[model samples]
Target: MSVQPQSFSSLEQNTESENHSSSSQSWTIEDSEQTYQIQGWGDPYFSINRAGHITVSPQGDRGTSLDLYELVTALRKRNIGLPILIRFPEILADRVERLYACFDRAISRYNYQGSYRGVFPIKCNQHRHLVESLVKCGTPHQLGLEVGSKPELMIALATLNPLQISEKEAQSSLLICNGYKDREYIETALLSRRLGYETILVVEQLEELELIQAISEELAIYPAIGIRAKLGTRGTGRWGSSTGDRAKFGLTIWQILQAVETLKSYNKLDCLQLLHFHIGSQVSSIRVIKEAIREAAQIYVELTNLGANLNYLDVGGGLAVDYDGSKTQKNNASKNYNMQNYANDIVAEVKEACDQAEIKVPTLISESGRAIASHQGVLIFDVLGSNEPPVTPPPVIEEEEHLIIRNLWETYALINEENYQEYYHDAIQFKQEAISLFNFSYLSLKERARAEQLYWACCAKVFEIIKHQETINEELQSIANILTSIYYINLSIFQSAPDHWAIDQLFPIMPIHRLNEPPSKRAILADLTCDSDGKISQFINPKGQKPKDFLELHPLDNNQPYYLGMFLVGAYQEIMGNLHNLFGDTNVVHIRTHGKGYKIEQLVRGDTITEVLAQTQYSSEELLENLRRHTEQALEKNLISLAESRRLLNNYQQGLANYTYLKANDQESCIP
Candidate 1:
């Protein structure tokens, strides 16, 4: 049966105007014509053009036009294939610099008393290139580092310490230690402080504060202290409860007061210099953030009023970056607030709240890991193939035909009339009856095949008649939706985008090329895995509509490679990816934009069979030896020839040398 055609609106139409100052503007396609203009957060950077092509711009760079077509061309030239993660250091630096600028502008505007310091949390994308870029970009601002684990701490300490970057700017970036602590963790924090780094041990539990105090005293170092308070106002996203009473970390109100009294009693209240609280990550709504910030600011004032030497309000990392351009609620991928608004709201609320409470405005410290790191990386994967609808054979009629077949043929003929509603209903009923009769063994195999063919023909005719109607029935619409094609992708959801499969995190996914042509198919993506659950049924269409489908893609073009980009994956994907099916990490390429164009500075190959086996304590040499011995014995037994045995061994070694997935160049060699 021929597929029915469907038309989709432009993505620009879905963008809502955001509230921005006169100085800040937005980008949009004007008048449904194919023209691109840069706008502020009011207009979505990602939208479908009139041709139904997905267009995207990296956050913050407005005037510079980098559409999907340009991105694909630049990426393909480097020979990076499917499941490749692209790192744009320029975009990362821009985000880091813009954040500091926003805070700097806010500080100057309000004449705020306290200093502002920001850090990139290592928990979000700890890839070497990303972290290096963050450190380099943030060196001007003395950007700090936040660590939650030993590995993350190692990365931060190794990169952010004064020893790494000898410049005066590098010496200024501080290190903030978070998460569960043990003896080694505390020792590392103290050691970092000893290395001339301003290390702040954020106390999640009161017991941790005591442990930290003891460690500081024992080590003979005056380490700074930051207390994470469990605020009453909770955020509204996936990581929303990260700050409230039910949060995994932070102290309760009573506990905070008790800790302050204990510190004062010990004359260590001066060490209690920073107050921290994390409402959540990817906080979509501004109202929730405003409320949470106001609550935290009030606590900061209370601590100050109690004569605690709290100089910094460590607003622990909730500044969100919108992954999906649609500013929807609790999507994890989208946010309702922008950077300027976030900074302004924090500064204004703190100033007002502190003034009301009769306390000094504490210095603002943010641990914005995702916002700093998410935009720096992009996961580019090629579409190896697509699943097309199966072709139906033409119906054959006999002189002595069954009654059901005759009735089906008659119904198919009736469906072609102009006023076809009644005929369509009759056709549908007759088809269902024919199918039931065939299933019940009332019809022969040949008759059943003819009935099925006639049924599909009737249905196809009915769809043709209703295709132009603006308002179709719900049942017909559902059928049409199912008929929408689905494309099978070449990447694993568990490996590349674990958050999407695990936490329902929606990253902005679009075709990396073909932006100039109208996409003919309404498609959902399927991954190459043995599991049936490896398909991506939900997608943000060019019109910004959420379309879920099982079969909505056209046949794959074997001649040319198809690619889909999973954007905003720079945050947690790398660190969170699992070894499901032993399909290790994707090959990572760090792309830096220069005057000449984009350059691939680093290419980290994905984990090979040897590397993956090493993790399980298996030696490749031993495995090869055993396989060779087995094959030799089989050859001696005449199960295989000597030539075949050698060929097999060589093939096995070659397989081990190659990547897990086949590249475009590999298709040229056909093994006889």
Candidate 2:
């Protein structure tokens, strides 16, 4: 499939009023001409379109595009409730295959001698289903696994051991151990090697080298060692400092020299087989990666010349996934670099640097956790009630209020006339006075409300008038752009997209339906959380201005359900979700392409009341007994009837069967 440029329009223009035109623009996805069938699944499935309307065609057969509505109905029929997480196994396989193909294309293009092996860091998702899918899909490439902690190491060891390999593929893939190490961690890595799996303990600090040496001598087995170098080149986004001098992990230049000497002294220099460095997670720019690889390659060449045996260049996890669909540097959460470009640049730069230093190109390895895992999962949420605009009476133009009302009226008239400069200034002054009057109790509440509404209406009108005019002041145009509509969506920001709530990471959010119509409201998404901070103010704007507050949304039905899909959340949402308001995890369903259509292989229900209580160490049995005893006492005292007491106990016990949040429908019968 050929790559096509994606266009982003200003959030201001997506408003409802702006979309009222004869010709409306909508996003369309085309079907892929190529297809392949999986072993069990009959038809081939591929992502044909990623634009406004994301479409998936099974088996590259363009007979008809599979509607997401059909997929949702199939899930609902299978009893998958609201707030569902649909896992497309085909998408997961596609990502793994595409990543390998990209690197292979780059290696061939640059005539690079070194091989490329990718590792799916389990820390990103760590779900058994996802890991299993990765292991199955990645078998052809011998894909590796990266673990940051001890438990993760255990998981990797159990799952990736050579014993698990089929008869045809006897050799095990690589296992890289990252993060801080203690005696237990080092011993675990050694144990993994003892199990016949190739394990590399990446030394993040100089002291770790000593620990590894001590353990190796004690165990009488030399394990492979990887040293993470602190590269000078840093990325320019939230995760940028992950590699520079101030980075948390990796060894400094002085420490690197010391590590080499220590390994040589212990006669373990040959165990030093890999050099690693991480610039950050979600590396946006190709240039930043190119520079960092160049710097690290030179270091690799220098170490090779010093007689250190290093064959693997581990470019630590920074391959970014574009979440917002905006290809820009500021939005690093959405990448400016794609897989092909990223791989090409890495291979080309490393090859050039290694050739200059007269050293053989080392094997290329990436610990890309986000790019491989993010697209496979999606968070589906139901829109509850919205915060409607408070209804107020229209402005009563009395003789005394004539001046203020006319001034407001004149601004709108001028805006409609394309008189931008005077209209903008007057609108600002009128809005301030309108607010001041309300503060001083000079204007009634109704009057103040009318003034505020009129002020915004005039601002919108001014922008619409100036949108087609080229001579308008750019500064005033920028201000008018922000006062547009804000749509309030339902879902907890902290529970759903925490990075957006914490570090302001932007994710691609759009309505599930109504792609054909132009958006009508300038809106900001408001979460259902009770906290005042539960809102999304930042959005994608086409003018390269700061994200605006409001966005346009399609009209919603009061009785029907409305949903918003939070895409690219497969990485960290599950493990990171907190029990704010005691809202537990959402329902998860594994989706895969089947003979006729898509199928839901598994439906893992959300946390039930009993399960959540268990997490807090609450004994449900004890609680049930105590409640029963209390009810019996009430019956003995005649405070409640015997039949009522029995009914109450049964009702309470039955309610605890599922999650606390779910409503109970059936009533318990009394003993009578």
Candidate 3:
């Protein structure tokens, strides 16, 4: 099984003219869509255009569109390199609009009196540009922000407008602080209340409550407070453990009662205006969502009866993005519900629970971070090279050939539909025997190489014979995978998409152009990093199938470049990346379309070699000094001439200023 069936795709090209014409006619945009599952996962934002290039319509089909291939060409013309992260702010705005629209419709259908307020969690994506864009687009709906740390609170305060702080100002944004708070954090949050912000310091622990009370007294500001309840109803999926009794954060029922008593003792019960609970992030089941809401609503009702004036129900971030486009609970990467469904269930469950208790329905607030941020980013990288088997004919059989090589050649020549399996087994045995003979010094290196070539040839022939069979057994499938190509991409899995490597999160990846041609090769992506774990083997399967180990790709043409886009990377990817192997961030570009064209509003350069080195405490000046010293020592010893030493130092200095990624070849600049 250790033998690699490498020559499967490297067999002689099919030269039949009629077959080529038929294949060309059969492959269309629709076929490409099905093959890549773009429509399944990339509904409103991405599609294949008439020119066989992938097009992005940030606000959906009727909105202005741009071809990704053309955009990359423009970037090249501007001297920007490959491995770019593109942000479409229009997509963010559209996601916000849809989120509010769904709740509005639900409110109308239910004839509910309470309104919906949306909040963006800063933890999902801490990038300032993305946070600012979401706040700008969401302010019209009284959209607010939720922060989990001191740094996030500062971001929220700086990004949000504080025109009016009074609760009566219905349009003023709210800031909900929900983490373990220290005295400094509490003081800052409570002080923001005086500066005209509707700031709520959500108490995650009973200890935080006393700290908030002491900080507010010291600052002479009464802070509006929220309590995070530990819900009995747990979520479903990978994040489900974040809920229920043993969750990392949140107060138990006893702690909630104790906090109410302590607030009553301080005559500050009225300051408790919000009740928050989070099921988890990316909740795949709608039923879990509804059940958690019902439980939390019951708590809200009881708290109201207990003299706590609660007016806001904050359902912390669990809105799922349909990453795989399955629209089912088939995997962790997908959700079975849409925005409308989520809004409807939350609204109905909360309304019913409040109605049964004859309590006023509180304003519904959702901290949906993933669904809002996931669709706005696309990561583009190029295929630097590929490792595939040779395409030449098999080695000629000679009378002087080794017996093992002759056996492999005979296995390949004699394989057919009825006996291919038997021949493949025989070939594997022959290969193992050849390796053992070579180890024992019974076979020459030339003879061993010939045996390997013939063994792979047999594998290729067997694959061709069985590929079209009605049933491909497990062994045949394993052989097929061993024969697939390893495409070395100009990307770092740790720096660009840590979730994929860390948690096996799947993202939709496909070529940006050449959709008209059918993909003829199966491949797994290998990043530029030397680490073995830095490879992408899990891929989104077509429609209803399970995830696969290989991605279908077109054979690379030497005359043109191949670019692939990784979709739905807007949430959690940017801020989670690490400098594994010192591979830093990719170049970032913000784009917005106008009518039929697009403009690049901003370009953030990636880290240079000196910058990454400095991040790890390597001083650039010191590095240069050390190199100069080495050059001087060489010169003193007459090991190298003065001119050579100077040239070496100059080259070292230039490399420090260069981008961490591989530079684009000058010849590929004219790829358009």
Candidate 4:
């Protein structure tokens, strides 16, 4: 068997009309939550509440649940419309705390002498509320910030003041300056050291090491330095290319030795206090991670043997987020281990390797940005509309029909699991004959239509016999997707989910409300963008199951507005987004959860039409002038009245000032 006994939803629509009503639906919150794999990816922080809404538990599931639907309603009442990015400072702080706690637990468990120093990488979700919260939350834990560019470093530096870090803690905290640094970048980092921030300039190449050494000599500063070794060991999954010999960053083995020799020549080997290597982000397997640690540890020992006074082994961030929520290691979006497992493995590997090499265990630093920031921000957008394929089998024509049409009807009538094999083959042959006869004008239009009706009825019956089978045949499983609904989402795919389009990153998406209602529709979300690629076709299926072609969704009642929330969108999505089709940015709201209720701390409106146009060199003044010229031309031709012309100009100006995205107006209001 390949399909379940349940036929097309339309077949059950009328029969289940009473059960489908809001107050009478029988679906449980737990059952609905399982459909979206809320527990798998959501972990300690997200779950279904009594109200059947997706709720946030910042301190984990045991904490108080904040209903997202309630938040949406509150925000709506406040006049802040959909397609909003919601930032949770509580979740942000909790992530940082949890990440640090894992390492601390591992350290205590292993009796490891060295402490863990977690650094928040500014490149991942570097929004003002998020980075500032990370800095503030990390102060007690002695967490640091890492930057790859000057602007990122500037944000880290400027935010430090507003952050709760004390003067002593700031002086000892690690401010890692990564990437290819120019003279200005190098000097800025060096200047930060003068300001008492413990900044380390991690050399990526021989030339960069030379630059640091030369700069240090001129400035009369014994600058703390680190070397990003190009490792022989490669990472696992999609980001592995960012490591190994093929990687864009870090120093080769020969280059590393040359850099050490150059530093020795400058009598600055003592300045080498950190040994760094990054095997890429979102590492899928702990096995590869342990191997990389073994390799990086050897290099660290060698550097220490060569008399470089290194004290820190900076294991650059790649703590996976389990985006698919499988909690498995098979895919790039998932990792096999939990936070404790990750910390324990890293610590045990470094400890055993260092103990064998007869060297002291160095302080550990992890730049795990994705794990910290991915849960902090969520992109919430609404389903503007939907395009569902016709679900019902067309009514059979009673008048004289083609032979093939009559045969298909007979086959459709006989379709069942007991004789499915025989009826399916007969129906397929009849459908092919009907198509051929119609193409050659041997069959009338009514005959072809009746033949299609019977053909669909046959297919629907075949599907009914297979959907719930233990293992559906690949070919049979694909048939159901043909009838999948195309949900027209309000947000732009390029602007909110660029990774989905660029790298096929899977983010958990589900409706915030109506978890108690059984979803009747299976859909693939299509965005408002004109490009064909602007859609979310692939979705996370159940554990050990293949990815689904369509996401199960509730039927869209035209009177009521439907809202869908895309979860774990905090990292990379914010910065990588583009103005594809000129769908300029969405609204943003900062949410902080408390004992009972959450507060809307801040609200940032998205770009207006004029603002977006200005980015492309079409200023409001220029657009107004162009409109004025057109109106004058029309006036010269006596095409309109002066009053009408004024009204037209006013409307055009208002359009320019309004948000580029469709606004929620009276016509688009949600029905009660």
Model 3 misses residue 41 by how many Å? 1.3
What is the C-alpha lDDT profile of model 2 across 161-212, one tens digit per residue?
A: 4543533455557899999999999997897787777788999988898898
lDDT of 3 by residue, 397-435 (tens): 776677788778778777888998888899899999999
| Residue pairs whose backbone atoms clash in candidate 4 | 2-466, 3-465, 3-466, 3-467, 4-464, 4-466, 4-467, 4-468, 41-325
What ranking of all candidate models by lDDT puts the best one first? 3, 4, 2, 1
Which residue pairs of candidate 3 clash?
none
Regions of model 2 farther than 4 Å from truth = 1-54, 57-65, 163-170, 390-490, 542-548, 613-672
Model 1 reaches what TM-score against the true structure? Answer: 0.85
Candidate 1 runs further than 4 Å off: 1-80, 163-171, 391-399, 416-440, 457-474, 541-555, 664-672
lDDT of 4 by residue, 209-306 (tens): 77887777788777999999889888877788877787899888988888888888888889999999999899988888888888998888888999
Which window of ten consecutive residues has the lowest lDDT sum in model 2? Answer: 31-40
lDDT value, residue 94 of candidate 1: 75
**Which model, 3 or 4, shows the larger TM-score?**
3
lDDT of each: 0.70, 0.70, 0.87, 0.82
